[model samples]
Target: MGPIGGKSKLKEAAVGFALGAVGGCILGATEDPVDKIVSVMTTSGSLKPVMDEVRAVGALGLGTLIGATALTTAMTSVIAGVILAAVVASMFVAMRSCTGSHEHSVGLWASAGFAGAIGTTLSGASFGIVVELIVKNYGMVGLLWALSFFTVLKPPLRFVFKVLWKQGEICCTPGSEVRSREREHIEITDWQQRQRVTLQIEQRILSLEKGGSTSGIEGRTMWATQQKEREELERRKLENEEAEMAQRSIQDWINTVMVKHVDFLAFSGIPMAIVAIVTSGFGLFGYGGHQSVFLVLLALVGLLGYFLLKSSDFKFWMLVGCMGMFAIFVIGMLTLHAGQVVVTTAVKMRAAGRNLSREQISTAMNYQSSLEAVKTAFFGAKLCQLGLGATVGGALVRRSAGDVKVIAGAASVAGSLLAGLEVLAPALGDGGTAGALLGVVGATGVSVGATAATAGRWSSWPGTLGTIGGLLIGALGMGKWHIVNIGLQLPVAYVFAMINPF
Candidate 1:
């Protein structure tokens, strides 16, 4: 035999190869998005179908690519942080003998944060150039093929890491091994003490059995107390052991699923996917003259989401629904205002004896709030910025002492400042990049806040309510003045990124 695990490795490879072949075949069979758009528009003689196809492709392809890029940016930022820490440590080594002196380590965190920000910014810029090059050369089909390949490779890679490579076994962070060893020692000592107590109790029971009627009333009472104490200790010990096992299992599962498979595109794509699905449902039902049926189906979905969602905490869903309702209200008001502005401007022009066309009025209403803006949001530069902001927000959450609310507040403030910078510059928000980036930051904050609120045994309803309330306040206040068009879909990605779907 080659090795004990050779057969399993071979089987894994075989499965991967089969899946990859199937995925490749499926991807290869699909037409390019551009080709599909051209064909659909030519046949239909309408922009509606073309826009729908574009939305589907944008969400599926560009969203995935942006997510992948964000992941790459996060990795780069981590590497940058490590390098900066090492440099700072070396500097401290020259100043102090121990190299880890508390006084000398004051700038370590600052240096790491600075390096991470700079590194991610540069990475984002480079990603834009790379994306432009890829599109120039391979087109959208390439993105499809790339995503398919990743999907196909994911399972085998997971198995290799979890099983063959045993990466999951080495789960401790720096200095955690020592703590783990200490815990084990304490547990061993406790077990030994329990055994001694058990032996003493058994001896006492034997003595009582041998001399049953000779004991006084006080002695029998003492024995009864001892028996109760022994039972309580054993019960407590068993509970502790069970709790430890459960904690370990939960942590392991989180590591395997959420940490390992952090896909931003999927996170961001979920909202887009939902929108697409709902829109498609409407179109299909309306086309077949079953508009009422579509409404019924939507209501059913709402009911299921309200009552039967077992995948995630129910409180989270409620918070998301509230946030969504607020967003819808904001969108409705904006649309109504935009319509008024368009009409008012058109009338003024007509009164001045210069009648404007419908196209001209529509153009004045701002393209940044349209589907075109959604398409533009996924532009390489903008997507990279949004991803970087989200990564930074998530890092802030990690650095806190599990106080997600404070970190989220800090992140939102930072994002607002970034968006404000665009306002001062004016060139940045002209493209809606500022809005998109700020949206991701705000979304990340809420996602982290929601996680902290509902993750533990007792739900922090106040925290959950506060986070949602803050989101609405920020959306209404900042969105109108600085970051226009902060959509609801992108936050879905941020939320899913933090919350484990499984």
Candidate 2:
């Protein structure tokens, strides 16, 4: 044959080769020999009719391609080929459906597309199964020929259904409008009005009978009962009014305290920053494996500095409480040094003879069984610290709000204790000890401070300072066994770098 002539024609040859290759692969990989043979024979015979139907449905371009390749066949039929074709076709249908009017009406284009794709794909598989069964009984060549003819007719059948569904006219009744109109026009307005009137008259008569019965009651007893009800309602109303007034007063007090505290912080920004730098620097440079302590202390110092600037508005005892919390933080840091020493010694003893992995060494030193435990302890401690900071800061800011200050103070103390427990519980395995101490300290301080602060009398600065000093000494006595360096290196460095910029 010439290059452009006979079976070697450019378009026909390419399409024929492709179809033949696909068919061959499908046949060779088919599950059953009989089914494969029959399927090919049926497809071959059905090609022409299928193409004709496809063309009639205005899919001539696609139909031509399918027609040209319809006769191509393979040695065997593969289940995969049928599955692949069905899936692709179903997906194409689903995409079309999504873009069509059905999806737009329901406002679920994506969901409909997904659902439709699955449904169609499954339907296609079912059709494939039917084709497989038919092909098993027939010959391969015959099935192939039949499928080619079937392709031409299938499109038209599918198109008819699509059109019918889109129009919603497939099973609808014709010329039913007259009946619908008659049904819509039917009315019983007069009867409904009469029924409503009858119900109203019945209700009125019942109410009159009840009233007449009540009027027959002894007048003195009825009068006393009415008076009692009136008094009760009046008392309840007064109580409600008093409660509302009290709540309003409390809210007003809180607002006033908040405004004063916020203003104080704003005014004392410079001094607060200085205090933060000093405290944070000391903690950072002096402590080993406790870098976070510096940051926490710095924040507290900054907050206190702000309070001092607005000392005129702050209650004396609130200042004392703030200072006391800071002292406790320092004490905790000092205590942690002893924990570190114990941890180091334990690790050393465990690894005395045998070679140990880095992970093992770390676990032994920390007295933690797993990395997960360490992570949990660290996270819990951080949460407790944050809670403590918030509580103390809120109390200082709202000290003038009576019992709120006490509550905040108590919460801060509890949070600190929880943080302590987070650290010690894992190492010591002691239950309730840490929690009990926290409750005792929190309750005592909160109750005392709340009572005094709510009394609306300010304590002297000397008295406030003395109380804080005493608390600091006590905490230090408890925690001073841990000796770690405490210095102001980081803050100093930061300040120097900022000023010099070198």
Candidate 3:
């Protein structure tokens, strides 16, 4: 029995590795690393482009790692991996012809796709091995190995894309040059018009000069008319020059502002996102016992990061960097939390109503069911948080005043706090009818009110009140009172609350 169990474990690990590699390859291809490298390189001439590419690669690598890790079931992992690879390979092939690179021919793309699949497969295999080793050792060494391998692989993958981009294996137009040429054309056309006017004025003057004079009074009048015409021509010429100057100045200002904004946003957002991720990571892993502290710290970091990124001047990479860091931090923290919940729940269940051996407790705590539940809850929370954040962020983005934006942010915070209370309050309460009833009422009321409030202005108090009343009547009992419970029991209700809110 022992030998058979060991064999099964090995088989599971092997399957996981194979699936992970396939999945990684597919996801990697979707990212179009080569195109991204080329874009950055063309726009920015320095190590900046390379660094940017590295960041993108790192994000994708981390995502791949997490995704592979989550697919614990061998069959599911394999299926997911194969599907991911096929989709990514197909996309790459489809886009290959669009680049207009004969050297990066259909054959070359096919070859690259095959290579990507192999690399991804290897990555997945490495992840599976690392995970298995970690499970066995349950030590810092295993964690370090995972992190180190990921860090090393990220740069090389990025470098490959960078090299391909440099070889002109991708194509993107130089927008600045295109705009400049367009402006030059407009200026040239204006200049031609001015020349034509000047020629017409000269022809009129020559015609007047060639005509013979009949009388002194008539000649004097003709002289006065010519003088007026000359003055008018001079005024028109001055107006044309002023218009041209104004147009040039406006164009120059626009170009300068655009460049400045892009640079500022990039600089500000990238650093802010990185800081948020690092801080969140430290809070999660460093102060494990004080989870509330970590959660608060993480939230603050995210809020600060959002503001810092938003206040930036609109640089493309700044936004990219910010998003990249955000994704990394969120996914990492969530994964850690999920793992903790799983381990804790398992231990609690195994040691239920007993003073069991530490080893027994530990072994029981690592049970698959607990881990799966924790993982699901963690991801579900993340998805909810992200969706809510996006909605609030989108709303605030439209507001020009910082004060108004702050109000929107406050609403988001309030909503999150309410949701947290709904989840945590029930856990704290004793398992009794009264406690359960109170939790149900409180959660239903808060969820309804908050959902309505988030949808629009505070003036919708009537609608908010109606929603709460409806939830209380329809979902307060029958084991369907919890927000999550409601979400599962009545998906339409949940969606309506999210969208309409009334």
What lDDT tens digits, residue by residue, belong to model 1 across residues 254-335? 3433333333222222322233233333433333123453354345446534543454644432333333322322332333
List residue ranges in candidate 2 displaced over 4 A: 1-217, 272-421, 424-502
- Cα lDDT tens digits, model 3, 1-502, are 9998666655544433332222122212211222222233223232222222212222222222332232211111222222233344333433332222222233432343233223323333343344434523533223334444443453354455335433431242233234445456556755665676678567767877999335668657866776675676566555545544433443343234223322332232333333333432443354423455446546755775676567745443444344434544555455345445646765676678645676554443233222332233223322232222222222222221121222222333333433443454344321121122222221222223233333233233443343333333334343233445344423322332343100
Give stretches of model 3 more than 4 Å off. 1-144, 148-171, 212-362, 368-377, 380-482, 485-502
lDDT of 1 at 310: 50
Q: Give lDDT per model, in order.
A: 0.37, 0.32, 0.35
> Which structure is stronger by lDDT: 1 or 2?
1
Error of 3 at 22 (Å): 34
Model 2, 298-318: lDDT tens digits are: 576557656664777554234
Of 1 and 3, the candidate ahead on TM-score is 1
Q: TM-score: which is higher, 2 or 3? A: 3
Best by TM-score: 1
lDDT of 2 at 179: 27
Arrange candidates by lDDT, highest first: which order? Answer: 1, 3, 2
